[model samples]
Target: MTDVLARRVQASPDATALVGVGGAEWTYRELDEHVERVAGRLAALGIAGEHLGCLLETRPATAVLVHAAARLGCVLVPLNTRLTPTELDSHVERAELAALVCGADTADTAVELSVDVPTASVDDTEHTEITVLDSVSPAEFAPASRDADDPAVMLATSGTTGEPKLVVLTTENLRSSAVASAFRLGITPDDRWLDPLAVYHMGGLAPIVRSALYGTTVVIPGEFDARATLNALERFDCTGISLVPTMLRRLLAAGSLADSLRFVLLGGAPASEELIERCEKRGVPVHPTYGMTETASQVATARPGEAFAHTGTVGRPLLDTDLSVLGGDGKSVDIGETGELVVSGPTVFAGYYGDPDATARAFSERGFHTGDVGHRDAGGRLWVTGRRDEMISTGGELVAPGEIARVLRSHPAIDDAGVVGLPDPDWGERVGALVVGDVTDAETVRNYCRERLAGFKLPRTIAFADELPRTASGTVARRVVRERLLDNGD
Candidate 1:
């Protein structure tokens, strides 16, 4: 297939391609020109067909680099801007990067990184040994003919449980994901998607690809400000949006959603019933989705109205995708029986980069082992229970933290909650909770959990906090919460 950008430009050169938070706009023709220019600069650096690390925020330049890499057949490695210099260095080494690209926000860190790659700065500011990306200009060149199986982008896992692994996605994988999403979400020619997610993550990267493929517009904010996002939704007449649960909560609290917004793709973490109820009551269309970096972006996504009816169900697997609930014996479990959720499809990632053994271990006869625990109902809908590794074994009874966290979040006063296993002498591990809410009374929270959860599943100790620690994608950072509990001797 032709490069998505080239195809989009051919189909509608005058259509709105991108809208920056600062009111900057780019038509398809203009965006394609910028991509070619960036591709030219990359070729000038002699980094074509190499692994290019991008440490940039959600801006037009970042989008340009993403497509430029595809045009040049270079593997785009989007580095998380939130990572420390040490973390960035480790990732660069692990990915075997040939060059690094930095925008204004990450220039200093790019310069500070220990990697010896040829670093290029998008901003006008000069770094001692970095090349200015804007200075180089070359004759336009045709987009490279990339095979469907050629790796297009490499993303690192959240690394909440262990060291982050690089997941390499091919051109076909991304394309399949984009197409499946459009079919599931009902894409239109004039659809505009609002993207406020970090550009490094799959949640952010997929939208750019989806918009390009659909010949639609994507509005990206400079940063995720609730009020700013609301304004952009109305101003851009965005037909769709991607957001985490926290972002949705803030937007709902700030004001009403615009009628122009048709669907809100909520993922990055599970959405609670309370949060879903709030959106339903406010006339906000929210589709709770289930997916991971390994599956491109979304494997299963509920329709907005269906999500409102089903509450926590993430819907069924998308067309061309297969999902199964497998037990410990690697066999399919009965319906409504909880097990590890495994997925298989064209959209599934190739494997971990440079780690054949790990990749082999990640896949079973069924497909890619998601490491997530969920169950399928008789209606064919999937319900996420928790992570396989995150189950708490207290007093020899296994308990899913998500089950308790869901109940805790149902409390009228609780805004957010994270459950983890704490070290204990009597029990192997004790159930513990960190809650974010207006309620200061820990006893009241515990009593609320007592009403809904089993005795063993109930949080042995509950701590109230103004907010819970979350990863860049907005999932409650269980490791961070566990560390806080350990540090406080709770």
Candidate 2:
């Protein structure tokens, strides 16, 4: 892949590249300069072809370094600031990070990782002087004696599987994914995106990489609050935004978003059909997508158009991408038949970083097994069923809790929902429900289900809570909720 920073700056050096929520806007020219300066500093520090843990907020310096690392062939290991010190330490050790670059706000967390591997504070960066990169070009940084297969980034996984794992990202994989996302979302120079996602995830990385690729302005959030995000839409004159289902649901329910919006790319989790319809009626210009860290960002997306009909279904695979469904018995399932969603393409990661066991488990000679269960429709739209590990077997029948949750959440009363199979004496396992809302206790919810679903589908027990458990990435940790319900008295 071509050097992203070099290419974009060469094409549109005058365009605005980065904008912080608090202050500071760096143009493409300025961004390129800072990247060279920092990489020069890193070369002085003797950090090359190695991992460096970065614990900074969304800022121009952090972004510049991501490219600088690519220029030097150094692997960037971005540590999530939200993670506890213990979690942070685990990642630092795992990535074998040689240094830490932190934003002032997250300096304490960075210190926890280490006091030794020199920490550079982004708050110390001065936006007063624009360092012109006139003489030094990114083209001067020739490719070292390394293949494209080498790791450029080491992004930590959400740990939904077992422990939080580090994903080795190659320049080619990230490059392909960003190009694919532009086509998937119809990104353009005029399309200014208000991004509220955490920089640790691919959702956040895609925009930064895209900014360097497309020369578009991406407004970063100082902090994430639904109301603030809504306010910024008009304040920043943002054309589009990326948000998970929960974030969008809160924004829509709060009724606080500014008037002008082109498309709200809602993904990270499949949203309720009601949520999509509400946006449609209100002219929110909603576009639901399907992606994960493994795929870089989005593999399939449903843009707002008449030709695109399915709402819940994640649209067709992007250009030069491939997807298939493996049935429960391990064969290609027919359209409409549920199976594991397997993705194989240029954008797909080669394997999990430093974990051969995980790499082996995730893929075979066939393709990269996503562990997500989904099936294609007549229109070739993929409707995600649930995760393979999330499947609950009650008696002899396999039950996908996501199916039950989708049906239950459709009711106006239910705000948030999760379904799990609980161990039972006679049936071996019985369905369980965890909901966040006012209406319906265990019996009432069970009776409500009886009206719409079979007796077996009804939750034997219903639990009410202020909120469902969520991973750092904002996906509902269904397994965590199940364990919580089973272990703690509810």
Candidate 3:
């Protein structure tokens, strides 16, 4: 369990471990061999207990390095490839990375970092000065044995608000997440998960670890084109896939689902009821999940049956996990009460990386304060409303953006919606909305909402956009939406 690849190879030596669409394929044994080589390369760079930063995308190489870092006993910091050097400077310094690894595409960005950490490259096709410059034989290196509580990866939170925190994920967190997800989703030896997500995020990285633990296959696509992803699903005989709401919507528009597909794990953001209904109509097994980087991946997920039954719920908490909705008084609220969501479990991360104060503020007596506002139903299904900080105080009445966005999405003409609070002179804040669809105008959309919403809940101002800004995980970037609204003078 310490060296997951080594153990996986021991258990299932010939099982398919990784499938690079139109590229290379590796069995568990081969993958383990490659991982050991990569770990040897890192060891040659003098990367010992120091944290290692990986500025790479979702590719076969990145997947190998993930296990390589674990094998070397170096805590991994999966740097976001989308971030600029300036945006990444703080994270690089905060993590105090000892050595940085880059792929062919991101090698230049790694050079741009202000920090003076040793850098290496892993471009298999080219032989540059930094490209796999050193190597050690498998007999020369020994994989470090890691405990369950050992920090595995220091992953950054999806910065929806233009601010991100570094969360420390342990082996136990990843193990618990994989086990619970497998129990809920059902896994088989032939299961192949088609992954199109960025490896820097938990959604993408989890599958790399989970597939090894399950002794299954991970199909890595070159890039996320709707047609390409759809083709890969069929070509690789993939049974499962992970996607955000936006990706799901686009994939549904692309083509029919592969008959070999078993489940579509839809998470990273809240999916509208319309989207879920569409999945149901298409006979797609969409399992809407609720999770964050702090929990490794999924805290709760609604299996297809439960998802269809409870359209908006994220389903029950996973095995060994506990969820509670606490009010302003910092006490657990009654069932069906809207309050701040609190999560405490083995799957939950220990704390943020290098931010003790922030970590202290994030947890309460119960558990990690998720800062997400939601409630549990009588059936114990979790319904996440919105962020506790995102609540719009329109004339002192708190309005959850999700509630209004749900109503707006219900409109037949409206394709999607994003709601936020705008500063107002009269009221402390006014409810504002940005919508996408073929609606006639903002007023028509407002009229549609007027029937369903109360006066304060109705949007004070509305704007139209072809698309709203979204984070990588597909969550609506409300901070960006708010800035856009302000710029538009809405």
Task: Specify the highest-TM-score model's number.
Answer: 1
Ranking by TM-score: 1, 3, 2
Q: Which of the predicted structures, 2 or 3, would earn the higher TM-score when compared with the native?
A: 3
Instruction: Candidate 2: give the clashing pairs.
Output: none
Off by over 4 Å in 1: 139-142, 487-490
Q: What is the lDDT of residue 104 in candidate 3?
A: 77
RMSD of 3: 1.9
TM-score list, all predictions:
0.97, 0.91, 0.96
lDDT of each: 0.88, 0.75, 0.86
TM-score, predicted candidate 1 vs. hidden true structure: 0.97
Top candidate on lDDT is 1
Q: Candidate 2 at residue 206, lDDT?
A: 74
Give residue 213's lDDT in candidate 2 (0 to 100): 75
Poorest lDDT segment (10 consecutive residues) of candidate 2: 127-136
Q: Write the per-residue lDDT of candidate 2 for residues 325-402, one digit (tens) a residue.
A: 887667899988889988888888877777899889888666888888888888888788788988878878787787
